[model samples]
Target chain A: SQKIEQNSEALNIQEGKTATLTCNYTNYSPAYLQWYRQDPGRGPVFLLLIRENEKEKRKERLKVTFDTTLKQSLFHITASQPADSATYLCALENGSARQLTFGSGTQLTVLP
Target chain B: NAGVTQTPKFRVLKTGQSMTLLCAQDMNHEYMYWYRQDPGMGLRLIHYSVGEGTTAKGEVPDGYNVSRLKKQNFLLGLESAAPSQTSVYFCASSPNGQGPEKLFFGSGTQLSVL
Candidate 1:
C-alpha cells in the first residue's frame, strides 16, 4: 500500500525563525508535489508546487523542495510570523486519474 | 466569484438515515471531487467526477454514492448513515484533468451521525 507521512508531533518556534516541514512517501512515483496551508475551521489553501525535475520552488516567503529519489519533500517558511502558524499538508498525484493523495499534515505554532 | 460552495454547513443525523450533500462550483472546472477529513487521517477521497454525468469511486467510497447531473454540481449521497460517517466533507474543483492542477475548495460541511 502507498503511504504519505508527516510529522505527527506539533512544532513550536519563535516568531521570525524559519519553520521547516517534511513529507515522506513510499510505494509511489509522482511527477508533481504540492503543499497546502489549512487554518482552523477552514478548508486548505494552495501554497506552492514543485515538479520532480525541479529541485526547488519558491513563492514570496515560502519555498518547497522535491527530491523524487528520496521520495520526500520539504516545505519552508522564511521569517515566519504568528499568522503563519497552521497545519501544512503535502500532496502528490495518486495515479493516472490525476487525483491527489495527501499526507497527515504538520502543525506549526509560532510564538511571539 | 464563488469558486466552490457546499450547502448545509452542519448536520446531525441518526443511524440508518439517508442524506445528500450538494456541491456547486462556478469555476467551470472539468473535474470535481468529494473528500472527508478526520482528526488523524488527513483527507481521503470519497468520490469524483471527470465531467457531467460521470462519477467514479475513489480511495474511500464504500458507504457513499455520487451524481454529477450538471457540469457545475456534484451530489454525494449516503444510503444509510453510520457513526463512522461523521466527518467534515469538502468539495473541490480544478480547471482540467490533463495534469496536476491546484484545487479550489469549499468551506466544508460538518456531519455528525449518532
Candidate 2:
C-alpha cells in the first residue's frame, strides 16, 4: 500500500529560529510535490511546489527540497515568526491524476 | 471577488438524514473537487469533476455523491448520513485539471451527524 507520512508531533520553535519539517512516502514515485499551510478552522492555502527534476525551490522565506531517490521532501522556514505558525501539509501528484495524495501534516508553533 | 463559497458553513443532522452541500466558484475553473478533513487524516478526496457534467469517485467516496451541473456550482449529497460521515467538507477548484495548477478552496462546511 502507498502511504505519505509527516511528523504528527507538533513542533515548538522559538521565534527567529529555522524550522524544518519532513515528508516521507513509500511505494509511490510522484512527478510533482506541493506544500500547503492550513490554519485552525480554515482551509489550506498553497505555498510552494517542486518538481521531481528540480533539486530545490525557494520563495521568500520558505524553501522546499525534493529527492526522488530518497522518496522524501523537506520544507524549511527561515526567520520564522509566530505568524508563520500553522499546520503544513505535503502532497504528492502521482501518475497522471490531477488530484494529490496528502500527508497527515505536521503542526508548527513558533513562540515569541 | 469571492473565489469559492460553500453554503451552510455549519450543520448538524441526525443519522439517516439526507443533506446536500452546495459549492460555488466564481473563478470559472474547469475542475472541481469535494474533500473531507478529519482528525489525524489530512484531507481525503471524496469526489471530483473534470468538467461540467463529469464526476468521478476519489480515494474515499463510499458515502458521498457529487454533481457538477453548472460550470460554477458543484453539489455533494449524502443520502443517508452516518456518524462516521461527520467531517469538515471543503470544495476546491482549479483552472484546469492538469499540471501544477494550484487549487482555490472554499471556507468549508462543518457537518456533525448525531
Q: What share of the true interface contacts does candidate 1 keep?
A: 0.78
lDDT of 1 by residue, B1-114 (tens): 888999989999999999999999998998999999999899999999999999999999999999999999999999999999999999999998887799888999999999
Query: Which pairs of residues have clashing backbones in candidate 2?
Result: none
Native-referenced Cα lDDT, model 1: 0.94
Candidates' TM-scores? 0.99, 0.98
iRMS per model in Å: 0.7, 1.0
For residue B93, what is the lDDT in candidate 1?
93
**Each candidate's fnat:** 0.78, 0.68
- Model 2: per-residue Cα lDDT over A8-33, one tens digit each: 79999999999999999999988889
Docking class of 2: medium
In model 1, residue pairs whose N, Cα or C atoms come closer than 3 Å (at least 3 residues apart or on different chains), thus clashing, are none
Tell me the lDDT of model 2 at B15. 100
